[model samples]
Target: ARAYRMEWPADMTVFEIDQPQVIEFKATTLAGLGAAPRAELCTVPIDLRQDWPKALLDAGLDRNRPIAWIAEGLFGYLPPAAQDRLLDNVTALSAHGSRLACEAVPDMSQVDHDQAREMMRRVTAKWREHGFDFEFADLGYEGERADVASYLDNLGWRTVGKPMSRLLADNGLAAIPQSNDSVSVADTVYYSATLSK
Candidate 1:
């Protein structure tokens, strides 16, 4: 599959395309709208939530080489068990010094089911109209989930950085007028964290 934002040279070996046309079009549009280093159209079957390291291993890609994996806007779609499973797979296939970057939706323990469903309804209007019918539970790492930082640290990764509310405020990000809980009962509990090996 083509790597977006990757820098390519004239002599660089290029791979074939294997993703959907819509994704390719979106990638190209993104590249056009932003200063992405370089991107190629590919013919890869893209599975955002798949066990990617296994896929690479099955494809004969070396597991010993450091790989950079990014999961954006995906953590919220998985259940807690699946989240752990995904992380386990990452640890299994990642060589020393491999890096991962992702955004997670944190826990939604405080949310009422009715509100959550209503929110989902509004968000999934298009899909629902297209015949989709499924309810989702909180799919992110609760700060309490096995002490995520420590778990990863034990797995050889280190807590590197995070954009906590205090950090954001220090960086001139104005605090919200009121507590997030007051604004939205379904608000998540934890700030995003970054970990690296």
Candidate 2:
């Protein structure tokens, strides 16, 4: 859809990386909708925890060119070490001026883990009621993690971040009220980083 809206750039290729089942399901859904990719689309079916970097490169990712990577709702599913490793891999593969946009979870030191978990459960239950059955707790790895901005800054990437409430306000939307659960959208911190040339 994005490519179509942009009139399909011939020089650009979009890579979709995920587990085999997810890739298959996405393909099926797109085909069922009678949709075709407007730009070159390559699907790499593999778990992110595996050697996905190699798999991506094998699928013809051009590391020499600036890349734009988006990790929407991804880090919360990975362990702290895995998150660091993922960033390391991306930094290594990225050429100068590469861009990364990701969701950076907050430091949960002051958050009540039990309360947060319960609230998250409630959110997931509501989602299930609406036909979104993905298990938030079962798939997530909760605990302490490094500050994404600091990590990227040390890695020579200039980054800007905004919390969910700020994002809403900046975009002229009313902020959703959040309780002490800390697991709500109040905890969402999005970061956009660019590797310096």
TM-score for every candidate vs. truth?
A: 0.57, 0.91
Candidate 2's TM-score reads: 0.91
Q: Where does the lowest 10-residue lDDT sum fall in candidate 2?
A: 1-10
Measure candidate 2: CA RMSD. Answer: 2.0
Q: Which residue pairs of candidate 1 clash?
A: 17-42, 17-43, 17-44, 18-42, 18-43, 18-44, 19-43, 19-44
Candidate 1 structure quality by residue, lDDT tens digits, 1-197: 23555666654333332235765776578668774435433333456366555555555555676655555555565566666676678777777777766554544555565665655556567667889765433332333244445556667776553534544567897664454231142232232233344
**Pairs clashing within candidate 2:** none
**Candidate 2 at residue 2, lDDT?**
39
List the candidate 1 regions with Cα displacement exceeding 4 Å.
1-44, 48-51, 58-60, 119-147, 160-164, 176-197
lDDT of 2 by residue, 1-197 (tens): 33333465578898878889988987888789888888888889999879999999999999999999988878988899899999999999999999999998778767888887787788899999999988776777777898999999999899999998899999999888867666567768999999985
Q: State the displacement of the C-alpha of residue 22, model 2, in Å, after optimal TM-score superposition.
A: 0.6
How many pairs of residues collide in model 2? Answer: 0
